[model samples]
Target: MKLPLKRLLGIGAIAAIVIVIDQASKFTVRNALAIRETWTPIEALGDYFQIVHWKNTGVAFGLFPGVGWIMPFAGLVFLALIVLFYKPILNGSFSFAIAIGLQLGGAIGNLIDRLNPEIGYVVDFIWIWKYPVFNLADCAVVIGAGILLITLWKSDLAAVKKAQPSESGDAFNKNFNAASAADKTHE
Candidate 1:
């Protein structure tokens, strides 16, 4: 297959996997745990990690509450933007593809909840002692964002390196100028 096509396919595959996993895990959590219920924390980890049943009508980390009604449309727009810019993703590096795929998957996963008015909230279960409860979709989005930052940082670094003149060339020019000055002094 052509390179761009192959890359796109790979991206699609990763996104599908993430979406599936996110949805499945959410389903299992909802089925197994009642809202506001919690399992015992693992003793080895102290309060660091536990499973809890919670729901968020807001954005990630439980922010921006009371906007549940708007999220479905927003999710649609987000997905549309991703589709529109997909060509750029295909042409970019592997890390870019992974980042886009992961973001896409996470968006879709949460979008599913938004679309289901019956649910009205995104199911969240994963908990850390000091942090708000979140779910697989949230995890995917955060990770994807982090990867995107790394990719951009690396790209910028490479560009800077490319724009810089080689040290050897600078040293050669300095030596040549010094030798010419010596010749002029002798003359």
Candidate 2:
């Protein structure tokens, strides 16, 4: 439950960066699409990617629509994950910590977006091949979560292997040594 000062500080800093990037990109998109009025596809991967503008009032992939209550619910889940995983997340491994950082940072980013908007709409502007529009934060969260799950699964497998009774020579060495000592005393 305890987090080292360095980790706590690193988490805070990354979260702040996420917020900044999310808001800045949103503002730019809003100005271009609303205030200044439009951007064409920044580039095209033969219909694979584009930079477009859309507003989403739901979780990733536009899962909900017009459900006003879900934003805060998403935010709560976000907060809970960060708190629950903080310590092991910090101590675990490289990929583990980075994945957690990405998740934590992305969560904070979207949560901030929902806080002030009139209907809790998030500004989403990235366009990917035939997919629902999303923003930087969404990408971070999804990729991070995927990596985190993979790491957890791998570690669980490793622990299981280690706990199995193995054929190694050191297996129960101390126990056998103690038994031999007792036998000598008896003789």
Candidate 3:
């Protein structure tokens, strides 16, 4: 379905905001924090916030290997997804689009740091796990992914519910059976 032009533009604007916020925060952190320095945890709901200086050559929570040679490969994946899913970003619900924006923004932000830095590692300077230190870009990527997963789950559920009754109807059942059989035959 075609999205209203206004909504489309709004989503674009929100995405822009994500990019701005993500980059600006990273820049601020870079300027303010000393590398490898850990600050006292900033308490929130249960001791979840803090600002420090850290870097990761790896992926989510520093899971993968070091910066090594994987940075460009991962960056390519990010770019591909953004390009492949551009339609969803433009046409999906407002929240979903914002989620995409956050994901994209976070990815691009970290990629910038990794690509530009001498060691090519993303600066990651916030920790709550006594965990591998992370930064705003990491937060954006995680939260955005969560949002995407939730939205996809919800959409799937909706589709299932919407399909069930139709599947039971006599005419729909006939058409569905034929379609299913046809699909099987093609496979």
By TM-score, the best candidate is 1
For 1-187, candidate 1 gives per-residue lDDT tens digits of 9978998898788889998999898888889889998876577875688888888888887778877678778778987877787666777788988998898889888888777767768988888888998998889889999998988767655544444344766855554555554334322
Q: Which residue pairs in candidate 3 have backbone atoms (N, alpha carbon, C) closer than 3 angstroms, thus clashing?
A: none
Ranking by lDDT: 1, 2, 3
Q: Which stretches of candidate 3 lie over 4 Å from their true place?
A: 1-11, 41-49, 117-119, 164-187
Name the runs in model 1 displaced over 4 angstroms.
165-187
What would the per-residue lDDT of candidate 3 be over residues 44-83, giving only the tens digit for each residue? Answer: 5235656776667677677675743576677688779766
> Which regions in candidate 2 have their CA more than 4 angstroms from the true location?
1-3, 35-38, 42-46, 164-187
TM-score of 2: 0.74
- Taken over the whole model, the C-alpha lDDT of each candidate is 0.80, 0.68, 0.67
True-structure RMSD, every candidate: 10.6, 9.5, 5.5
Candidate 3: residue 173 Cα off by (Å): 6.9
lDDT for model 1 comes to: 0.80
